[model samples]
Target: VRNNGGGHANHSFFWKVMSPNGGGEPEGALREAIENAFGSFEEFKKQFSEAALGRFGSGWAWLVVSNGNLEILSTPNQDSPLSQGKTPILGIDVWEHAYYLLRQNRRAEYVEAFFNVINWEQVAKNLEDASS
Candidate 1:
């Protein structure tokens, strides 16, 4: 039950991280941070997508700000970065429930749509909060 709660929390944040009008490169501090941490935004996206796609089962892919750096990681089931003492800045739900409604079994397609709705502004805010 607690795990379900965590999954819900993570999923809620994941939904907010995206927007219908969001795809494209991040700007401002988030962009600079991405460049510094992951070499480039493209690289960051590639890593993020790979992590999301690689989850063995229902879970989440995350971009977390930890120890003054950004890292891409995947959480199994309802596990979250909060549990590992990291601050989650962005999250992508890999659960079938999250995408089956829109993309059916095409997880890759769902992953692609993620960029179209990424809320970079909110992500930047999360990063700022995490850093502070």
Candidate 2:
């Protein structure tokens, strides 16, 4: 029951992290923070997208803020970083339901579209809240 609750909560936040009209680069402290933590925005995107695609089964990809740094990670089967002591700044549901309607098995294409719809403002706010 607790695990099911966690999955629903995680998926809820995941939907808001993206929109039809979101994406590009993050701004303000989030941008600077990404640069500092991952070396550059491009690198950050590459790492994040790679992590999203690398997961072998149903799961999520995440950008989490931990110890004042940003990190990319993957969690399988409804697991969330919230359970691991990290704050989730951004999340992408790699579960097939997230993309199967539009992308079928083309996970990479789905990931690319995911980038096109990232709510960076929400991510920045999450990062700020987490940092503080």
Best by lDDT: 1
lDDT of 1 by residue, 1-132 (tens): 659789778878887888888878789999999999999888998999999999988988999988889999999989999888988999998989988988889999999888888989999999999998
* lDDT of prediction 2: 0.89
Writing each residue's lDDT as its tens digit, candidate 2 over 1-132 gives 557987888988987788778888899999999999999999998999999999998998999987778999999989989888888999999889888998899999999888888989888888888999
Q: Work out how many backbone clashes candidate 1 has.
A: 2
lDDT of each prediction vs. the true structure? 0.90, 0.89
- Alpha-carbon RMSD to native, per candidate: 1.1, 1.0
Cα RMSD of predicted structure 2: 1.0
Candidate 1 vs. true structure, TM-score: 0.94
Error of 2 at 34 (Å): 0.4
TM-score of 2: 0.95
Best by TM-score: 2
